[model samples]
Target: MSAPASPQELRKLIAASSWTGPTAGVLDGYQQANLAVVPRDLAFDFLLYCNRNPKPCPVVAVTDPGDPVIRLGRTEADLRTTLPRYRVWQRGELVAEPTDITAYWRDDSVGFLLGCSHTWEGPLRTAGVPVPHAADSMAPPVYVTDRPTHPAGRLSGPLVVSMRALPGHLVARAVEVTARYPTGHGAPVHIGDPAGLGIADLSTPDFGPPPRLEPGTVPMFWACGVTPQLVLPNSGAEYVITHYAGHMFIFDHHVDETP
Candidate 1:
C-alpha cells in the first residue's frame, strides 16, 4: 500500500499497532528519525557519542529526561507511542519487541531522535536519482561494518550502514543531491564494493531483506543512525529502548531546513 496521506496519519496507524513495517519510503518530504531511549544518567555521554559520531547519529531533537513529548519548533511527538515498533534491551541483551512502550517508559528515560538516511531519499528522487527502494514498504538493507566509531564514555561499537543500489550513471548526481541534507546522512559512505567495508555477502544483511540490484546499478552505503543500536548493546547499558530495524519516527521538519 502507498504511505499514509501525512506523517501524522501514518503515526496514528503505528500507534494503534495497525502498521509495523519499515518507514523508508513513507510520508515523503518529511524527515524520519531513529529512536533511542536511555537512562537519564547515560544521556550526556550518549549525546557526546552522537556529537563525536555525527554521520550515523545526526541529532534531530532530544527530549528532556522523563518527558515523552518531543518538541521541535512547532511539531511534537510522543516517545512512548510514535514509532511503528520498539526494541527493549536489558544490560546488552535484547528482551522484547513491543508495539507500544508505555509500560516500559521510565521517569529517568531520555528519548533521542537521530536522523535516518530515509530522510533524504525523497529529495534524491526529486533530483532525478533513482532510489527504487524508497517507494516501497520495504526498509533498505543494513549491515555492520568493520569501521569503528569514536566512542564516548561507556559506549563503543563498529559502524552500521544502510545500502541502496543506484544506477551507475546517477551515482555522482545522487552524491551531490544527498550531500545537501547532512542531517539525513548526507552522502554515500561507500560507492563500489561492499567487501571494503567487510561485508561478506550482499545477500545477507543484519537487517532488512537482500537487495535486488538492477543492471548498471551500484550499491551505495551510508552511515546509519542504527549504529547506536549496536553500540548500546556493546556498552551494556542497564536498559534501553530503540526503534526496530527499518521502522522510524517521522518528524514534521522538511529537508529544506537542514544545513
Candidate 2:
C-alpha cells in the first residue's frame, strides 16, 4: 500500500489497521514520535526521567491521566489506537504486541510522545546526506548501549541508540543536518566503533533490523526513543505500553517546531 499523504491520513490509516509498517518516510515534513504509557503511580518518575535524559527521551506531547488524546499542539491524536502497533508489558515482560490498546487503557494511564529521529530524514535528504533506512524502507537498527541513563525515582536503565550507516564522506553533513533538530536527538552520540558504546555486534540488535552498510561507510548512532521501553523492565512497573519499534505517532509540526 502507498504511504499516507498527511499526518491525519496516516493516523486514520493506522487506526484502521491499513498500515502497519515502519513510519520512516510517511507524512514527510511532519514530526514523528515514540509513545510510552505508564500508570499514574509512576507517571511523575517517568516524566522526570525523560526530563533528565532529554537526548533519548525528548517529549513532544503528553496525555493527561486517563485521556487518550494528547492535549498538545493543534492536532487531536489518540494515543491508544493511532499508532500502527502497540506493545503491552506486564512488570517489564512484553505480554502482547497489538494494533490497538483501547481494551487495556486505564483511567490512571498517562501517555508520553517522545521525539523520533525519523523526523530528521527529510532534512538529511535535502542536505544531500543519504539515509539508508529511508532508501531501503526499513527501520534503523536499535541497540541497547552500555551507557546508563540518569535515574529518577524507580525509572533507570541503559541508554538505547539507533544506528544508521552513511557514506564516510557524508557523515559530517549528516551530523550538521541532524544537529539543527535538537528535540529529535540533536546530534549523534557516537560516530564510529560500535564497541565504544558496548554494542558487541552490528549484526545483532536489541530491536529493529540489523545495520546495513556499504564499503567505506560508517555507522552513526543517535539516542533512540525506544529508551523508555528498555527502562520499563528496570522500573518494575506492573503495566506499561509503548509503540512498536519504528511504528510511531506522526504530528503536524515540522521537526524544528516546538510541540
Candidate 3:
C-alpha cells in the first residue's frame, strides 16, 4: 500500500484498472461513498428511506434519472465505471458482480450517493485513537444486527454494523471522536457484549474477517453504510445497484460537507 491519492487521481486509477480492491485507504482526505441506483418510480420513497435513516444512509447526491453524472460530487464523475466494482441486483437477488454497469444503465434509473464511515477514520487517528484494521492494513469485520431499521415504503430490515476493538480505556475517546462526524456514522451504537445486539459470535461476521480483539480491549460497533444495501432486497425493489464491499464512490466534497 502507498500514500492515498487525491480523489481525482484515485478516480483515474480506478478507471485504469490499476486498483481493484477495497478502497479503504485509497483517497485518505476525500469522502468515499456507497452507491444505490433505483428506478425513477421508486426514487422518492428510497430518498425518504435514506432521510428517515440518516445514520445508515446520509445522502451526498442524487442524480437525475437517466443521468450518469452526479452534479453534486466531482463534476466530471461517471457513476457507471468509476468504482472498482459494483453489485447488480434484480428483483431482490444479487444476479451479478460487475466491474462496469454500462449495459445495465437505464434512462429511468436514479443514482444515490450516501456517506460512508471511511471518512471518520482520519479524525480517529488525529485524536490518537488506533484503528487496528487500517493500521494493520486489513479490513474490519462487519455484521448484521437483529436491530431492525425504521421502515419506509418497502425499505425495512435489520441494521448492519462494522466492528473494531479498542483498548478498554480508549474506547470512550474513540466514541467521542467519531461522534463529531455525525454524517459519517456518529458515535457507536453498541459497545461491548456483541451478543446483546443479537450478534451470535465475534468469530463469524456476516462480511469480512473475524475481528482480532487485543488483550484488555473490547469490541465496538458502528452503524455501517452497508445496512441499506443489505436491507434493500427486503425492500421489495425490483432492481438495485450498489458498490461491492469497500469499493466506494469518491466524492469531490470534503468529509465535513457530507451532511
Best by lDDT: 2
lDDT of 2 by residue, 1-259 (tens): 8867788888888889898877878777788888899999999999999999999998887888999888667678888889999899998789999999999899999999988888889998888887777877787788999999999999888999989888778999989888888668889999999999998899999887867667888988999887887887658888999998888898877777775
Q: Where is model 1 more than 4 Å wrong at Cα?
A: 1-3, 16-20
Q: lDDT for every model?
A: 0.86, 0.87, 0.83
Tell how far residue 177 is off in model 1, in angstroms: 1.2
- CA deviation > 4 Å runs, candidate 3: 1-4, 73-75, 257-259
Q: Judge candidate 3 at residue 188 and give its lDDT.
A: 91
Clashes of 3: 0
Selected candidate, larger TM-score, 2 vs 3: 2
Residue-by-residue lDDT tens digits, candidate 1, 1-259: 4568877788778787788887877777788888999999999999999999989989898999999999986567787988989999999889999989999999999999998887788888888887766666667889999998998999988999989888777889989988888789888888889999999998899988899977888889999877988888767678999998778898776767642
Rank ordering of all candidates by TM-score, starting from the highest? 2, 3, 1
Worst 10 residues of 3 by lDDT: 1-10
Task: Name the lDDT of candidate 2.
Answer: 0.87
TM-score of each: 0.91, 0.93, 0.92
Q: Distance from true position, residue 112, model 3, in Å?
A: 1.0
By lDDT, the candidates rank as 2, 1, 3
* Cα lDDT over the full model 3: 0.83
